[model samples]
Target: MDARVIILLLFSGVCLTSAGLDKYSFINERKTWFDAQEYCRSRNGDLASARNKEDIILMTDITGWTESWIGLNDLNRETMDLYPNSWRWSTETKSRSGYMNFAPGEPNYANKEEECVDIWTEGTWSDGECSSLLNFVCFSGPSTDKTYHHINLNETWASAKNYCRTYYTDLAMIENEEENQQASSNVTDPAWIGLSRRAWTYSEATNQSFRRWWSYEPDNRSGKQFCASVYKNGFSDMGCTSKLPFLCSDGIARKQSRIKIMIQSNLYLTNQHNKDNMLQQLSASLTRAGQTDFNLSWSTLPQKLDPASLNDDHQ
Candidate 1:
């Protein structure tokens, strides 16, 4: 091949390689045990089913949380059934024959009626109630640079729009299926987004239009659902008066850092209210420097270093 042609082929190979690597990145988020499974399925993957101690620890660190869901379920409450044998993997590949590496009396099936599987800190499987709400883990296509912002309180559709505009660039908008799935992970409460039915017609919308559907389904049944968010993967016709969390985007770094400092200072003051006046003054000064929005009262400070020593000092 000519030198130029060879160089072109090498460049193309590098680009393709980068794209392929990008497709395998792991996403981290919290979801209902079932939603986690569905999220993985939607992305052509499954809930992270850890098969060994190392894998479990890695997952624990990835989530930075103690407990999360795995893809194990006891569809049949058979006590004699050994897990990894009785339980089928969510991905549905053939299960590798394995031993029930329980820690002492584990898989206790505690009630002999437990039907779900969860990983304990000991790196072993235990039976849990399937219906009980627990945080779960889901694996999917590679992660992206998508950022999320949570709205503080409920607001009218117009007010929500204005808030996002004034603070961030626009109300949170999902660009693709990956972003949509990722957004669902952060939401603990219902939130508002850029999508609306009354503010704009769905037909005139572009692919990037402010309007969005939670899951791929649009809410055409009710006259509400004029707002959107990352909490649920679908839209609901909810009244605007009903307060729910909302989403924002494009946050400034300095503002976030300042907010975090203020919160920390407030927490410190709350815990150190009985300290010396100098310390109390110092806390107040720090709070002010942080530009905290809340008031920190110091009028209740005790006059004596130790109230019990009041009589002793007088003596």
Candidate 2:
């Protein structure tokens, strides 16, 4: 293919197949899961689908603590069977160390509204409502010194986060057993920590069996927690109406297009040199057009093919 046009001049027909490159984009606007789906569709895409670990990492790295929505959900919870399959961190910028210390039988999604988490004495964690007024702990500088400050003033989870950010670093981030113990050492009562759940699917409504759930999540305690949200580590169930940022995937990446042209030259159709030159020129043109990830392939026409049978119409 030339810069302005592609020309084929040979005895037989030549076919070129171009494969698209996949991409995942994080949309910062907050919207309900269904609304997000509509927005993505309007833009010729859909809610992002993490088909594998790489997809998950790519999408997660786009934003921090935004708790972006994914395509997985249990909208048919009443008819279709489901299970706990997700979790997240309160901070988006920091990496999750995969350390968890939930109390046994805890995180039961008490009252079916407990999405925020708190730590009690003995370093055990529990899920509770974000609006619950509780004293929270904040860490100054880094966790290296185990430097944590317990604010006795009662505040909601959101308020506590602001308070901590204004004074100390942020809400205490407990990365491991020792950090969890240190954060809880001075806690005489359950207080807010830097951990929470936002918490599903591809946007195409294709049921995917692959799941990345927290140790204990998707409890579906409310039975109405049918939607799924994503964070750093895993996914978690949330109410469908909850508005949040989301990830959208351009579906064009998975599609491959094929174009066939008739050759008019007397040279043999199997000429490797001609094929190589055509491919190099075509690849260069595509690269100049800012398309680098596409693939190209060739197919030969049948022996009995007639040049007059080829049409200019491209599929």
Candidate 3:
């Protein structure tokens, strides 16, 4: 083969390799401990099975210390595993990997019940109860809500419901096709809603009150359910795990009014301050000009000098 052709082929091969590596990448989101593992498994990967302190730190920085659920769990204590020691991450069906970056004296298996895993700071791992509420991390993919807000930060389903109640109304009860599209467009994370079969019957009588799922029917046989949340493009059954994101809405009119008031207040304050500063400067100039003589008794100036007229030109 010609030398030029050989060089061109080598360059093309390098570009293909780089693109393939990039294709294997994934983004992360908050999820329940169990769900996070399941998510990793479903994707043919596990919650970043890091193997060193550097890897842990890298993940923490990327996830903003937001506390995401990893693949580690001790649900099967039948294997003679302790809390932290028994902690092993499920790679789903991926290859087994190890990342031992633990805190000082960590993986001590403090409590038998503490089987779930989480990353604290850097590569450090800690054992937490699977049921205990904590932020979770899930690999990124299409989600329910399309937009997100800061007010939706770190809240459980129950807590989110209450928050919406005390501040505004109930958890966002998505209704109609328009609302569904709006909800999907505004989700940065999965959010809890008010559509659960645990609290009420999903029969024909109450069908009007609940949001419909886009796909699979949730196993709502048990009545322990009391909340609902948006996932993918439809709603889903979820426990009140502190691992999901939430949604809050401000009616467009109310939000616009508030914004207008804020703008008006800011303008008023700025103008008032400017007026005061101008007055002070004028007063100083008058004093320096030896115009104190003009500060006569009120009787001297029968017609009060209009303060507004006292400009630089008048001075």
The number of the candidate with the highest TM-score is 2
Better of 1 and 3 by TM-score: 3
* The best candidate in terms of lDDT: 2
lDDT of 2 by residue, 1-315 (tens): 222122432222222122224466788898999999899889988777665566666667776656888888755333221222244443332334667788887667666477778999888988889999999998765333437899998999999988986776678877788788778888999999977654443455432346787667787766677777888868888888899998876744343445557545654436665565455445434544544235555666665666666654433
Query: Which regions of candidate 1 are displaced past 4 Å?
Result: 1-85, 97-101, 141-315
Whichever of 1 and 2 has more lDDT, that candidate is: 2
lDDT tens digits, residues 1-315, model 1?
111100000001111111122122134454544455456566655444322344434444444432334433322233334423344322222212322333455545555444444333333345554444433322222112335455555454445545654554344444354444554455554444433221222111111113233354334335333222222222333333334332111111121111101111222333333223333334334433532222223333233344333221110
Q: Judged by lDDT against the true structure, how good is candidate 1?
A: 0.34
The root-mean-square deviation over C-alpha atoms between each candidate and the true structure, in angstroms, is 26.8, 20.7, 28.4
Clashes of 1: 9
Provide the global lDDT of candidate 2 against the true structure. 0.67
- Residue 174 of model 3: what lDDT? 35
How far is 50's C-alpha from truth in model 1 (Å)?
32
lDDT tens readout by residue for model 3, 1-315: 111100000001111111122121234555654565456556554443222344344444444544343322223232332322233222111112222434565434346444444444232345544444433222111122212122435554445544644543334333244433443343444333332212222211111122444366444425232234433333455443547433211111111010001111222322434334333333334444532212111011223444334222110
Model 1: how far residue 121 lies from native, Å: 2.6
lDDT computed for candidate 3: 0.33
